[model samples]
Target: MAKLRTTFVCSNCGYSSPKWSGQCPGCREWNTMNEEVEEKTKVSAVSSVKSKTVFSSVSSVTEISTGDELRYNTGIGELDRVLGGGLVKGSVVLLSGDPGIGKSTLLMQACGTFSRDKTVLYVSGEESAKQLKLRAERLNVNSDKLFVMTETDVESICEYIKVNKPEVVMIDSIQTMNNAEIQSSPGSVTQVRECTNLLLRTGKSLDIPVIIVGHVNKDGAIAGPKVMEHIVDAVLYFEGERNYAYRILRAVKNRYGSTNEIGVFEMGDGGLSEVENPSQALLSERNVNVSGNCISCVMEGSRPILAEVQSLVCTSGYGNSRRMSTGFDFNRLSLILAVLEKRFGYRFSGMDTYLNIVGGLKLDEPAADLPVALALVSGFTDKPVPDDVVAIGEIGLSGEVRSVSRISARISEAARLGFTKCIVPRSCLKQIKTKADIEVIGVRNLHETIANVF
Candidate 1:
């Protein structure tokens, strides 16, 4: 009989240790070390038969031929755009998000489109067939070519895929998958890593695209070992607020697509419907001539999107002034407030300030700084910015507005949305080659911006 071995592994970074520790030495995360058991197999006598060796010739980059037929459209334009064009052959995509964030619904909706001309196999470890059927019905996803299997054993599932050979395969989740040969539990570091490896290998060998759903931990990161993300070809994150109807799908890593691309969707009773014009959908409820509101354009991949920045400044009753932000970085807000107080002499020290980006869309671009500053000033002065005006520039600590890339695209998008005037960096004026219909005002400093907008 073979003896069992015990080891402690870091759940966050997959670092192994002989003894358990309160803090993971690899990731330096506390309480992430978990004990895992492994069974050691006894060595047997080697066979006398000779093994066959196979050799393959390597081709140069120019010699490799890639055709358009290798990609399959998921019937969702927004999803296809995020995927670079379409789902490529032999690629494994891992989609993760918070609970009730529409991760499963997105995949199920894509399955409906994939089953139109190809066979799809959906293997679920968490939900039963009845539950999936109910969801499919609610989403109006009915097709003869789409098949669902409720099983937790990954080994058996891979074997079935190899024999049946489905055109597309989807694992409802990778965490619930368990291998009988593994001594650890299903969602443990070892099991999730090994199961993902098995699925990746199966997809690559059969030239089939596999989409796997992943669960998020308490910190909103994908649960299980980080190596699982490294094993997959692409990693996508579905982001949105539970109370909000809009959801954003972003690619963190992709072998065949750009990581900067994003897909927008709106959750309804029928399921997730793609938002064709995200800028329009986001600004549909804009209240014109409202104080504390300013519009800014942001670039998501090659696409330009307009988002509203809103701020509220009021007297603070507490000892410490409170600063809060939603869908905008809190640290960035603090820095912006500091710049305002030190550079522009706007007093935010004794005030409670709150900032928000409409439509639950996070503003990570520095170009949004101008709008944020304008919105803060508008809220503080209780003055409304012109409804036809849009701001696009990066605000520096020295009170200067810095140049931003793709300034023309940003201005063009704002103009298309019926904005009459656009405030841009003075340095980027030369970058605008063609004349747009809207009026462009270039400002070199924050004082110039306030003089024009306010």
Candidate 2:
């Protein structure tokens, strides 16, 4: 056999180089280059074949046909909500999470629903057919229309799709699938890109929705080339500790619907069960009269969720005080501490502080800012915040309380959860016209909030 030419490729940024380099110039990372077999192609033979571009006249928006039915339900309400109603036909979705994060189980459960009326094909590249069967049996997913095949070759999977013509298809994982035409390995950039391209073409051409599972790196981002995320119609991430029973499904990108929507599920012995009332589930284990604990209402999409923010403040023995946060941004915590120290003259300089959001739910929005500040101050002063009170506002650098969006929804959720008092921004208070069952108090700054809460 003739010598097969090879080239060095950067695994991180997918930049190719003629020779080896200790550091990749593209991403400026050290020693990420790997040698891969380079397939030589005869370009002269195909140069004469010119592909003509076809153009069509643009039509009015009213003329466009959005069929009678645009989406199909996955039979799981929470999953359907996260998917922006239901799975859009001909739309490609990429689902990624850590190892054993119930990605496969969730997809399999959706498959069982799709197989009820529509033919569904599940192409697994990781697990064997028997292994899948046993797992399916354990999950109690039985459907005659659900077909399972264990294959890694992208070409073979395409062939199966063409022959079966299933209404919905799922690739167990994109990393495991490979295109024979690509000289690189299965999980390499070239193979993953080509395989996803093939699947995208197949799904679009057949008007079938395709769901591809992805692997996440140690940094909690989807593994493989960054372009993989851009090529898909939607990107869903599974979040929550593996040790915890609850899992959150959030959409980072969605072409058909809002990305703010989230799906809550509790991993049980049978399968994942949807948590209809997530706020209740999240605040069920709250201990009353705790010095460092405070309730906050944060809006997740259109849904209002009540979360517990806990803080611990103690005098630091070390020279440099340590600050730690779980399910909360560390930089945000530091900024809040700075505001408290500079504006209010409260010293957290010699203290070690820790913050945590209960139920493994991350507080990404600014609405939790005031509650976190309250929790921190409460911990430092060794005073318990009112148990029946829920805080909702954003803290500014000048120690002023700022208004948050969907303030009405947040207060309403807090009221429904049996909270008697709600502390909100003064600006947001004017927006509420009707009287709620709960007592609403508006504060202009953090000092007024501290006076009212403790």
The C-alpha stretches of model 2 lying farther than 4 A from their native spots are: 1-33, 37-64, 219-225
Give the lDDT of residue 333 in candidate 2: 94
Per-residue CA lDDT of candidate 2, range 1-454, in tens?
A: 4346788877667778989888878888777776777766523111222232123335788997877778999999998999999999999999988889899999999998889899999999999999999888978989899999899999899888988899999999998998876677777766776688788878876789999998875331123535488889999998898888889999999999999999999999888889999999999899999899999999898999999999999999999999999988999999999999999887999999999999999999999999999999999999999899899999999999999998888888888989999999999987986466999999999999999987
Structural similarity to truth (TM-score) of each candidate: 0.93, 0.92
What's model 1's TM-score?
Answer: 0.93
Q: State how far residue 206 of model 2 sits from its true place (Å).
A: 0.5
TM-score of candidate 2 to 2 decimals: 0.92
Q: Which candidate is the best by TM-score?
A: 1
State the displacement of the C-alpha of residue 142, model 1, in Å, after optimal TM-score superposition: 1.5
How do the residues 1-454 of candidate 1 rate in per-residue lDDT, one tens digit apiece? 7688899877778888999998889989888788888665722111111122122334677987775588999999989988889999999999888878998899999999999999999999889999999999999999999999999999899999999999999998888999887888888887888788888878987899999998876441224526578888888889998888999999999999899999999999999999989999999999999899999998998989999999999999999999999988898899989999998899999999999999999999999999999999999999999999899989888989999999988888988889999999999999997477999999999999999998
